[model samples]
Target: MDAWATFWGWLFVLVLIVFAILSVAITIGGFFDVK
Candidate 1:
């Protein structure tokens, strides 16, 4: 049960990082498109 909790915690953090990266990328892309 402890191992499962740790695994899920890591997965959640990784997902947040990926989501932040994608959001930044889309914002940058939109900025360039307006140029």
Candidate 2:
């Protein structure tokens, strides 16, 4: 049970990190977009 919980915790952290990175990339891309 403990191992299962830890696995989920790590997964959640990984997802959060990926989301943060993607958001930053999008924001920077928008800044540089020619419009």
For TM-score, the strongest prediction is: 1
The root-mean-square deviation over C-alpha atoms between each candidate and the true structure, in angstroms, is: 1.3, 1.4
**How far out, in Å, is residue 14 in model 1?**
0.3
How much lDDT does candidate 1 score? Answer: 0.98
So what's the TM-score on candidate 2? 0.79
Which segments of candidate 2 are over 4 A away from where they belong?
A: none
Separately for all candidates shown, the number of backbone clashes (residues 3 or more apart, or on different chains) is: 0, 0
lDDT of 1 by residue, 14-34 (tens): 999999999999899989999
**Whole-model lDDT for model 2 versus the true structure?**
0.95
Which residue pairs clash within candidate 1? Answer: none
The best candidate by lDDT is 1
- lDDT for each of the candidates? 0.98, 0.95
| Candidate 1 worst ten-residue window by lDDT | 26-35
Candidate 1 deviant stretches above 4 angstroms: none
